[model samples]
Target: MSFLDFLASQFSKLQKATLVESFQDDLDSSVTFEVVDRKIPFLPLFDVRRLEFQRGSSYSYSAIYLNKHLRLQPIYFAVQRLTESFFPKLSSLGSALVLGCAGCSIPRFLALSSKDCKITGVEYSETMIKIAKKYFIDDPIYHYFLLLHDDAFSYVHKTTEQFQLIYVDLFLADNNCPQITSMDFVNSISSLMAGDSIAIFNSLCLSKEDCMKFASRYASSFTATYVFDHQFHYYVVFAKTSSLSTLKAFEKRAMNFVRLDERFIAP
Candidate 1:
């Protein structure tokens, strides 16, 4: 390793981490779920709680957040940063749907960020839903969120209710859920959207080329489509309206939400 790489690795080892919980779901023994709490090395005042799922040699983090203190709020996770900046402009919207409710982070964030946006989160794992309730969805704001234990694919295909905003974040241990890239899933999501609506997709696991290709394949279904790069992560957005005034407004407001100094954004 180079000098900087060596230093970075050593510095990472300094953080104190505790494995608070671990379990292998009976439904899927291939993956193990864990919840961890780790203190920032130099900044002892802050701690991060993370929920991770591991399969064989690969792993995926479902949620990460600094321990909440009085009035101090830190938005560090890239997905949360994107959500914080992206959702407010759509405050007039009444409902949102989350395809994969890992750790309930997005659901909780959406509820807190937009009071009127009733959030519905669907997760396949029963244990995951229990864990989310026990660990993440404790705040009063979550009253606006209705978390269901069901396969996102089946739920999407069956739910007749439409949403003004939809967030697709399905993943399994660093691997993209097979259905997320499928045409059926795409069509189902399109049908679930309101006439004037937007969908945000998390494509962090896909390469830039693959993300672009995937976005392009689905572009014809939406009036406006955009692929955005933020802090080395990529997100694809689709809107039903011909005009992109809301998206443009988000660009200006995003500066306030994504400035480097406000949050420690390193993964």
Candidate 2:
């Protein structure tokens, strides 16, 4: 590696170590983490009794932040990486929907990247939405952002509006992505998408076989499907408009963004 690259790597390692040490000290305390937004203190009230960051293959960091000091570490890194890589296309669409938006990370990223796009996020957890609005959502830049506190399934079944992009990431406690993998859910999502719309499903299942099963089921409803594997049990399922040319265009946009921002790297 070049000298500058090596230096940056070392600095990143140091920062991670420091953060871990601080997290350990605050594990027993009710600590609030804040993100800077125009010098405003937007703190997420989490009793983060436990926090762990694991380094997986492909230079990824998987973080597990527990509420009751539990040591339950779920699949986090791969999903985050995949979302960052595919976010350009997901955000550039005219209208989008994000189901199971915990803390609204993907929605915030989308809003920041494509200010003109309309984003509707459905989240069951009111507390999570509150935290997301405070820390993640930028009201000024994202005038078209709408957050709904409701069940994902109910929202998809009721909403008559069509979307150009749809993202789903549903999981229960202890990293278990329930068998909400029903055909009805797939049909509901498909009916709500536009002609060239795309749907992305994030799963914590590591096996390619399992991921393909999910993709195939989704493909049964949509026009086409593909899976982006980000090692460590994180899989991104893309449905509809599976043209190779379209995918290549999306990848080119993602690569360009990666070149501009070092924090964004695809698996």
Candidate 3:
């Protein structure tokens, strides 16, 4: 069968299997409470607060709340793709920062992918941070991960620290992008980077126009920008310089990503 046909068939089977129903049930069944230090419960569905979980030693999910309506599907897909494709290339970076780290999911993935790199995560909600720390403990990957409860925009504006990789995934809701995309905010983030820094921005509402808008905003501050779409999500990569070395690094990293995971290839 053709690839599209196969995808459709698989999707049909998934729907029939009641994937949404199963997740909803899991969310409903998961116990909710408070814990001290490192033992916390995972909430897979919408509740008064965001959900947090620690899977084995590396993977985890932290969010403000679950969507019984299943709005986070795209975010999960984008995070998975980024973890598989972008994390491997960041081994050499000494430091990294994740903006709008809801449940610290991306930070956990970064920790697992490169245990030696130091990671600092900035989050706006204290409740979310409390849930994340309580549920997501310090594993080998998390040993180098630090969670800071603060507004992402304020953190970027006030901090002068430079990192090799900067990741932004803040959002208003399931479908809305945050106001941090303004030119001033983008410029502030750009100023926090070193000579060879790379910034990755995640946009949930994916469309050609959305991609162009992000690219245009990023272009105002950065010397180079590239946009890619996968599984209905838009990703924009910005760089300080359009050097041959930088381009080569991106190509090498992308190729290595494709080699490591078949899902990394553009669909």
Candidate 4:
């Protein structure tokens, strides 16, 4: 690895370790803290607590400030770019799906941004769902959000409903869920997408070789794909149908939500 890359990795590790350590210290003091152990093999103990902590469950899937602190990590900034900064029409979307509801962070953003948007979040872990409902979801009628305790794979295949936008943020502790990389699953999901639909696929802990190759292969499943690398280790893949290609200068069309700091951006 290059010297700069090594330094960034070390910095990221140190930051996460420090944040998680502090969060662990507060676990005993709060009554809201909920701990859920592995419901299946290879899953680690998932901890759900209230506020002020940067999210780092399982591995480092997504990091964001909870409660009032609001230190939205880079991956979330990437999500903001993908969701808020990609499509201006997202505000009017009728239906949306979030495959993995980690802390329900992105869905929260979606619900708030699009008043008319109806979101259906699928999470396998009941504990996470409970935590999300308590901390993430805002209102019952206004937000129009629903959380389902089911495997994302089965739900996507069986659901008769279609969505305008789909966010695939599925991951376990350290490894990504197997279906995230499956072509058959992607094809099944494609069937549930509207004509102008888009799907955001996140693959964390990616090597440069893996990122480039995976981007090329996965882009084939859609009309076009946009790849954004966040903090070296994470790759956010935005794949959309061919109809979306007609939009002129689509990337810059979506308005800015947050002005990201230079320190947080990847080279």
For each of the candidates, the C-alpha root-mean-square deviation to the true structure, in angstroms, is 7.3, 10.2, 10.6, 10.7
**lDDT tens readout by residue for model 3, 95-210:** 78899775565666566556587898997766556556655443444667878878888888888788877888785434445565678788888888777667877765556576
Clashing pairs in 2: none
Top-TM-score structure, candidate number: 1
lDDT of 2 at 124: 79
Q: lDDT tens string, model 1, 30-135?
A: 8888887776577544555668776766344554444433111222244555554555564555899988886876675566566778899998878888788787
Candidate 2 residue spans exceeding 4 A from truth: 1-10, 16-92, 242-244, 247-267
The window of 10 residues in a row where model 1 has the poorest summed lDDT is: 258-267
Ranking by lDDT: 1, 4, 3, 2
Global lDDT scores for all candidate models: 0.68, 0.52, 0.55, 0.56
Candidate 3 residue-wise lDDT at 63: 32
Could you tell me the lDDT of residue 264 within candidate 1?
A: 12
Q: For model 4, name the residue pairs that clash.
A: 52-66
Candidate 2 residues 57-129, lDDT tens each? 1111122222222112223433333444444454465788988765555555556556677889887755455
Q: Which lDDT value does model 1 have at 191?
A: 96
Q: Assess every candidate by TM-score.
A: 0.77, 0.63, 0.64, 0.66
lDDT of 3 at 99: 90
Residue pairs clashing in model 1 are none
Superior candidate under TM-score, 1 versus 2? 1
RMSD to native, candidate 4: 10.7
